[model samples]
Target: MTESPSVITKRADFLAANRGLRVARPGFVLLAQPNDGKGKRYGITVTKKIGNAVVRNRMKRRFRELLRAQLPVRGLPDHDHVLIGRDGGIERAFARLAEELDDALARAAAGKGDPRRRRPARGNRR
Candidate 1:
């Protein structure tokens, strides 16, 4: 797929729409929210905690491919989706990853009640 149709290129956009809905699976975590514009925009986030730069980049690549293949069909219109890669993402089979993404999207869209879905408390640790 072309870059313009499948990517969410701005940090501000990601954060502003961050409060929508989330779905977690063993392979990845998906955060999705309604967008103000048309089409589906996506972002992939692989944190340093997953691995070194090389490993992180590999996971991001996997996510990009998965999104490219699945998003157009499974994704909702005018929504921004951020795919957070988990350590297992790199190892999981592509088919399984796609299945997980399908399930996550469905659950997120259905607005399943997620008990652990609240923001953390803010306070001084010390």
Candidate 2:
């Protein structure tokens, strides 16, 4: 099923949790990080090294689609995500994006421990 906006978290939340997923190829890096405890929100990072707005947008679109269709199914539903687009060939193929996304999500999900658990307060420290 498609992920609801409420289920997507933002970038800040993911960073705060110290949870990240990355799959790198010669052309791009696919990354997914959990945001808030609500839903999945995403950010796309493409440097000038890739291309202009047109090219960058294209890459972003690819990543967006990959995440929209497959990411929620594979990775954590409650996380923030950032997909960095590479240059040359990696920018062109959709399958490559799909494959890398799958791999990255798998890697991120491999660690199943919860990051939200609270530690004992200083008063309880012994």
Candidate 3:
């Protein structure tokens, strides 16, 4: 299922709740976090260090495409995730970022803290 833009969590909320999920390499850092809601939502954060507007926008576009292709298959839901692009992002190959995202999602799924842990209770707990 695709996440609609309307459901995307605002920046303020993301900062307050996302504890962060990090994967580091010599060239860059990938930080992801769980959003406190249903269906997976994503945002991108590229700083000046990454490059000027042209570079930043390109990075965001790459992250968006890779994430869209890499996520829904795993059934991630109601989570707000942010990918912070590091310096030299413009030069990072598209496939590399996609692979990193796939790996990161695998890591998230393996952990108990994965935002997918929450499913609306189907019945009365009592």
Best candidate (score: lDDT): 1
TM-score for all models, in order of appearance: 0.84, 0.66, 0.69
Model 1, stretches more than 4 Å misplaced?
Answer: 1-4, 116-120, 123-126
Instruction: Give lDDT: candidate 1, residue 33.
Output: 85
- The residue-by-residue lDDT of candidate 1 on 7-100, one tens digit each, is 8888987785567787888888888888887578899888888989998998888888888877787777788989888878888998899899
Q: What is the C-alpha lDDT of each candidate?
A: 0.80, 0.62, 0.61
The TM-score ranking, best first, is 1, 3, 2
Best-matching candidate per TM-score: 1
User: Model 3 segments beyond 4 Å from truth?
Assistant: 1-9, 25-32, 112-126
Better of 2 and 3 by TM-score: 3
Clashing pairs in 1: none
lDDT of 2 at 99: 76
**Candidate 3 per-residue C-alpha lDDT over 14-53 given as tens digits, one digit per residue, 9 for 90 to 100:** 5743466555532245445565554566666778877778
